[model samples]
Target: MKHFLSINSCSSQELLELLELSIDLKKLYKSNKRVLCLAGKSLAMIFEKPSLRTRMSFQVAMTNLGGASVYVKPEDVGGIGKREPLKDMARILSGYVDGIMVRTFAHETATGLAEYASVPVINALTDWSHPCQAMADIMTAKEHFGKIEGLKFAFIGDGNNVARSLAFGCAKLGMRIEIASPAGYELDKGSIERANAIKPGTVVQSSDPIQAVKDADLIYTDTWVSMGQEEEKAKRINDFQGFQVNMDMLKAAASHVRVMHCLPAYRGYEITDEVCECENSIIFLEAENRLHFQRALLKKLMSSN
Candidate 1:
């Protein structure tokens, strides 16, 4: 069984293939082809954290592929990898499900599950990486731009998992990313250094959003405060104080620039509603691509015959 735990788990060529696959799937759906490629196959989704998009999109994706997904809450199973040990849980889940997806706080928890499970284990969302969302975002970029390389994108806000994956994706594809964050909120030095090492000239770090986005093609940002960091929310708000993607900042980029966000957006915080619903915003299209990307992902993981 193959697993998708991080962006680095896939090569640049494979990432492009996923983008193409997602486009193909969207076309197929429009042509009245509801693919059930995984018919009779079952997947178990273990959630150590809460979600809206991750849960809905994956479940719907499995169903669209003619498969079913069973949701497993922490309390339902001795609190996931703790009550009976991670390896033991993996061994148990592998028996009944064709695949497993876990959303949790730790990256190692997903890696541990992948290590022990005979079935494919997916990282739905972890504190350290968000490969699936990046996959969808890149697909959006491909559809919107009609090309991937040579695109100058900028990510402005907290350097969370989303930003890390986006930076990796851009670097791997020979594109440039200008990331701007408050002093201490920059992308994990480790993740940035690794992406830079792989594709040296493609990643740039900045402290000013305007400078980061100078003539950028795709402008991006994420919520100022991430999940499980409620205690730091107030502090983050104060620190990220003039950083929202409003009209003034949008005009700072190129005339053809498009804005994107992985939603559940805090309106006045990370971005303004004016930008979210702007005609230039492909944000909704990006959200829709999540379904197609998961369809392609499931087809890839379960078609390992």
Candidate 2:
């Protein structure tokens, strides 16, 4: 656990331990208990993509832990890996910060940073995976359902970063995940194979949203148009026509099914306003859990003990 790069990089025990820590932190936070585990630490956050949750969650998590964060944009550093080598930047930043967190377009940038830096590097989000978001998501599901293993999880949308990470998380935790996506938007073969390798028969893919949600314990979705894909917005909207998670999709799922969405949700697009505000939706709770999970993660990565 040197670097929180991807869910696939973590063992089941590590994932569960982080979740347990997150739960404990959440309880302490609600009770107004002061947690200063990383009191003297500093985190450096580098961003190549625009963000809301990723930026706020890591910054607030550091604040809650009695630590501080420094936000770095591409222009601030003369463009990451363009003006200077990634290894050189990684080494320089590691000398100043206790940890590094990056939200970038290429997955290699995060991994490359981890390779050269002595401090832990966390993948805030990449075009390929969103491990932190998945951690918070699983925490929300566990808090709601009382457990995660053996749960039937269904993901309906582009088989993008969120869906990929969720599949890996569910597979590692012994939950079965089914992803429903339109043709050409399905989860990549390598990702599916890796997830199934973690837990045999853990990931199932399909084209029909209704079939994927059948008797599912949790239904998840993300925006069809992700950051950097603005050019394809119109085509994505048309291609994902029947893929929206609405009342009709919920009606097909189990009676106890809960809904989750990684935020910055597009109302009337990936999900409807009705479903976003429904009783079954834990979207807001899921968002809040991001802070808790990242707090636990920072403490684990930066604390002396």
Report the poorest 10 consecutive residues by lDDT, candidate 2.
33-42
Model 1, residue 44: distance off in Å is: 0.7
Tens digits of per-residue lDDT for model 2, 1-305: 89999999999999999999999999999999968888879999999997888889899999999999999988998888999999999999999999999999999999999999999999999999999999999999999999998988899999999989999998999898899999999999999999998788999999999999987999999998988899999999999999999999899888899999998999999899999999999999999999999999998888976
Q: Go through the candidates in order and give each one's C-alpha lDDT.
A: 0.88, 0.93
**The best candidate in terms of lDDT:** 2
Superposed model 1: Cα runs more than 4 Å off: none
Model 1 Cα lDDT, one tens digit per residue, 93-146? 999999999999999999999999999999989999999998899888888889
Error of 2 at 38 (Å): 1.0
Top-TM-score structure, candidate number: 2
Candidate 2: which pairs clash? none
